[model samples]
Structures are given as structure tokens and as C-alpha cells.
Target: AAPAAAAAAVHEVTCSAPVNIAVIKYWGKRDTALVLPTNSSLSVTLSQDHLRSTTTVRCVAADEAGDRLWLNGKEESIAASKRLRNVLADARRLRRAAEAADPALPALAELPLRICSVNNFPTAAGLASSASGFACLTYALHTLYSLPLSVSEASRLARVGSGSACRSLFGGFVAWEMGQRDDGADSMAVQVASETHWPDMEALILVVSDARKDTGSTEGMQQTVETSTLLRERIASVVPRRMRQMTAAIHARDFDSFAELTMADSNQFHAVCLDTYPPIFYMNDISRAIIRLVTAYNRLFIKPVAAADAAGDSAPAATSRGYRAAYTYDAGPNAVLYLPREHVTEVLGLVNHFFPPPAAADHAEYFGRAASAFLPAVDPAKVAALAAQIGFAPFPAGSLQRIISTHVGDGPRVLARGHVESVSLLSATGL
Candidate 1:
């Protein structure tokens, strides 16, 4: 829309990444400051449709005192913690060196980075915001700095922001190694398998509740670490066995084995959460209802299979022929269900039946107070029109907002076609 001369001078680079929810959860921390885990954890990266963060890092030399960050087009104050700043500084330094090494190199660090990020899904709803945020940040910084950091190295940097962020650096199935070193240099993530490797895998993300939790993971983990003796058994005994079994299941393409292990591990993680001193409550009524539905569905399907196999006089086939579904939950009310791709529509239908939209009268009754206060002088017809514009639909008379469905997907990637700009003095001089 502007002059060609103004447009040609600016260069932009955009990067995007998807969020992942851990099945074998990373609950405790060995080094809180470094965000190191006490034990290894595994997660599946979901498709960008269900949840994702898109970050654009454009460099410009402006007279600003410090870098700025924006989320969904609104300016946000950077977190007070210096971890992110340190990572950004390191990337900028590398960029500067790259510029110096080549006279033709464009200066990228001197330009102020206008970072605009948006989470397609809810933030702080226990849906892994750290996973997407840190992954997107790392990916953007690496590109902006012109650094040769591999995905592993970028993951290590992201780990400093949040323990699970490391896993988000990779696609599909990923494992975060809990390094022995206290410094956390060895703590990083490695991909187990690409989404292509397991073509039939599908994830159904049920958004049971979007309300922000009162206690953050940091505080909750600290409490559990200090008090829960059951957690000692979980970390020392239970998780290691489950981790090994899960790895084997993924490799062998054993859905039955995988489903059983995934659900059990999730339950154990929540069990440890409840055993904490004063008991931190992560799951709610809606979450339990989802669990009940999944369990009943599994039992209903498995019963028929068991009965059919048992009736046969010949030796029963060990492997499952029909589609299998498994449900796993994280720290919040959201449920991540893994199933065969063939059953996706069936799953969606079931989800929709459980959580329908609110009715028009119910919506009016619920929002009547706010509507009355805001539009006291407006016409009744106009008020109704305004309410419709706000996207207030009658959901099934319940608390749940909606379901977010996604499947396993790829990690962070660069978008070269977008606008780009140099951040330093050298680039401005066209050196």
C-alpha cells in the first residue's frame, strides 16, 4: 500500500510452530532457574490448527530503549525474568558476528525486533503455551541472527524458558532427556519419530475448560517436590518403566500397547499431583466427565472384541484389527485423545454430542447483565444484534467452551516470502 522505495528497504522473516502436550509429564524440576527436569518426559506435537504460535521477528534500527513484544496485536510487557532476554542477546550477538564475517552480510541485530506473536488457542489454559511460545521464539531468533544452531541447540535454549519447551522444538514424538549435569548443558530434546513415520496417528484435543488455573506449574511443582512422598515413587519407579514401554510401542506400531501405556501414565501423573501436600487440584468436573466418557467408550468397544476373541476355538489373534482410541490429560482440564485417523469423524461427532453450543435464550440470560449495563440506551434490536456480533451462541447448557481437534505435526519452520528488514546500522548503509 505504501511507496515501493519504502517497501524495498525493509526485509521481514516469519516463523511458526505448534504446541505439544506431554503424556508422560515433566512434573518436578532439578534446576528451577535453568528449567531442568528431574526426569525425562515425552510429548506429541499437535497440528497448528488446534494450537500454534506465529512469530514474526523483523529488525529495524529505531530509537527505542529496549525490545518490544506484542501478542495478538496488543503490546505486552516482557516477563521480568531475564531468561528470554539472555537467549535473544545471544542470538543477536551471533547475528552481529555473521554480519562482520561477510562484508556483504546484512546487519540484523542493530534493528529493533518487532516481535508479534499470537496463540490460535487459549493462553494459560494449561494447553502448553510455553511449548509454542518458546519454540516460536527460538526459531525466530535463530533465523534473525543467521545462526547455524541446530534444532537440538535451539531446544536447549528454549528449555531455559520452560522445561517442556524443549520438546516443542521437535515434531511428532519427542523426548526430553534429563541430563545428569547440574548446569543443564546436557538437558535437551531429540525427536523420536516424525509425523510421517506414523501416518495414521490422530490427536483429538478436547477443550473442557479454558479458565486459567490459580497456581502456575512452577509453584505447584515446588510444592509437590517439597512434600509429596508419592512423587518420589512416581519419579523413581513408575515413569521409567512406562517410558521404556512407550518407546517400544511407538517403534513396533502397537496401538493397544501404546494406548494402555498413555492412559496409565497420564493417570499416574495426576495421581502424583493429588498426593502433593494440601493437594493441588488440576482437574475439574468437566475433565472427569471427559475421562468417564472415554473410559466407558473404551470399555464398550473392548468388551465386544474380548467376547469375540474368547468365543473362537482356535488361538486368538493377539493384535487388534479395529481402530483404538486412547485418552491422555495434562495438568489442566483439556483432554488429548490419540486414535487412528479413520475414526476421526466418529470422535468429532462424539465430542460435539458431549459439548454442544449454548441456546440463544440461555446466551441472552447469561449475558443479560453485561448487555443491560453497556447498552442501556440502545434499542432492543440493536442490543441483540450486538450480542450476535460478539459470537455468543447457546452452547449446551454447560461450562465448556468447545473442542479443539488436532493431529501430530512438524516443528518450527521459516517463512521466506514474508517482509523482512535489517536491524543494524550496517544494513541501513547498504554495506
Candidate 2:
């Protein structure tokens, strides 16, 4: 009884992980269970200051109830969840390895776990919340139990939860190498470069809609792999070449090459989706409008001033002239734009004027409209004068839900260390 009581004492850990945007998307898996991707991919980890998930892990005496989880205050069972089960098993294996190596380090070795995850962004808006969530969970486990594993090792554990989750374990530019092995032992994320490597890079997240995407990425990718022959072409021909090009562009800090590849790959990813037998449409009219607006903005500014007027009288002509920015979208409608820090304000002004956010306090709104005013990028002024002069592109209302502007950031971080009472999602007794 004494030993049980000692072991039952609640131990807690809190960690925060950033969301990652895949520049080279991972669409299909070679082995679904292991999340072994069909091809290698790369992503940029967003700052935890703006887009991230905070998770608290607590362990207590085992009960028949098994593992428990809470995502943004919603209770969920981990017992039947394949992703959670794999993540927990992986963590325990590492803990066991740690225990075997050291005689005095088995504090929370045989206890049930309760995990709580909360995201700063919309969980269902296709913002890579699962990637951040699983990354945070895996990181917290290692921190809590003092497991002897590197960040990459913990990333492999997160990969079991979601393939993209592996990329979140590294800061700034990261690549998930699709290692050629049946066991998937070699498949894991590696840092191409740290966040500081590209300090001038800026990202603006335009929340096109808070509505949940109809087809989740996992289901959509499965359908693509099974039905879309284009996916095979992508895996065999397109992605490999793009992956090489994207990596070199990042290394060289060539924004033009990087931006061009980013946009092209995103378009090709959607193209393959359409190629699917029962087509999956992730982007709607609003998304298409944003795409057009970006291209127009680039042309209007990049081309000589006379060329812009030669095209038509209605271009969004601004004095700031250059194709210094780029845009990319995931499986969802929301768009993430990359640019130099200096250009964020100019571009953001255009985004707010064109695709305005819907009016509502809204449910689970990430940053919501409240986050707009605080954008370090720019003031979301209706830009009444700028719009009238440059010609406002009136997009449909409610198409946009919110906006969050942030730069690339470091990977996962420990916010609170050692017995943090406030951060724990589990109850006082580890219920």
C-alpha cells in the first residue's frame, strides 16, 4: 500500500509546440500504421507566440479506465484511439529504456496518464492543430518522465499520431526524410536550418473561415492514394524534384525560387485531389479569389508602372513594387503568406480590405477578430483611402474568419517546469 501510494503521487509536465506549414506537402503514406510518407517533405515551424498548442501531462495510479485525455476541455478516451495508444506505447518504451540505464530514475514509470491539450488557433480550421497537439504530447511525456531521447526520437513518437507532427519537433526549416526501410526505423524529421537561419522571413495567416473542413487530411490522402493515379506520378516524378529544389532554395535564401515552388506545389497538391475519382474540393471560391488577388498584386507591383496601366484601369496598384512575397495553402481554405518583414504591412492591408472577417464573437475562434488589431504585421485599417484609390476587390462576406501574423519560430518549448498547479488540465488528484 505504501509503495502504491508513493507511485500514485501525481506528476505533471507542461509543454508548448508550434504549428508547421508544409512547403513540400506530404500527401500519401507508404505504411499507414507507421506514417511512413511516400516522399520526403519540408515545413516551417510557426512561432508558439501566435500559433501553438499547450499540453499538460499528468500521471497517477492505474485504473481500469485506462488513459484519459482532454482537448480544449473536451474529455476523450485514449483507450480506443489508435494514435494515442501508439504515442503512449512509444513514450513508455523510452521510459523503460531510461529506467534500465539508471537505477534511481523510475518515478512515474507505472502510472496512468491524463493529457490535456489546448490550441491558440482553430483546432478544426485545418491549421495543423494535430501536428502541434501530438508534438506537444510527445514532448511533455519525455520532459515528465525524464526519458533519455533526443528531439528527433520524440518526433518519431509524434509521427505515429500524425505524419506531419514529426516536422513540428524542429524549429524553423525542417524536413521529414522518407527513409527507405520496411520497419520505418529511419523515417524521422531533421532540421534543415534553425529559425534564425532566415530571420527576415514573415508569415501572415489569413483565416478564410473558421468552419471545419469537410474532408480531413487523413481521409483525403487515403482517397487520393487509392483512386488518384496522379498521386503515383507525384510520388514518382513531381515531389522528388520539387523537394530537391525547395531544399536548395531555403539553403540559399532565395525567396523567389522558394516562393515559386511553394505556390506551384500547393496548386499541384489540389490538382491531384481533383484527380481523385470522387473529387475532394478543399478550396472554395473565396480561396480562388485570394489566389487571384495575390497574383494581381505581384504583377501590378512587379511589372513596370506603365505595364500595369496598359493591362487595365482596375489593378490594385500600389507604389510598393516587387514580387517579394509568396502564398501557400494546405488542405483547408485558410492561406499562409510568406514575405519579407518589411512587406507584411503592405500585403496585410490588402488582405483585410479584400476578404474581411465575419462578424461574430464565434465559437472556439482562434485569435478571432480580436487578434487582428494586434497583428505585428500591420494595422487592419479598412484602408478606406487606399481601397478607394487602388480599387477595392470586394470579396464575399463571412468568407474570412480571422487573421494571425507571426514569424517563423523555435520548435517545442517547456513553458512551466515541475509541479505547475495552474497549467494541469487534470484535476487536483489527477482524476
lDDT of each: 0.71, 0.80
The Cα RMSD of model 2 versus the native structure comes to 6.4
Q: How many steric overlaps are in each model, in order?
A: 18, 0
Off by over 4 Å in 1: 1-11, 93-111, 303-318, 321-323, 354-356, 360-396, 417-431
TM-score of 1: 0.79
Instruction: Name the best candidate (by lDDT).
Output: 2
Clashes of 2: 0
Tens-digit lDDT track of model 1 for 192-307: 88877787888766666778877788889888888889888888877776677677677677777678778888888888789888788788876776666566556535533443
State the local distance difference test value for candidate 1. Answer: 0.71
Q: What is the lDDT of residue 73 in candidate 1?
A: 62
TM-score winner among the candidates? 2
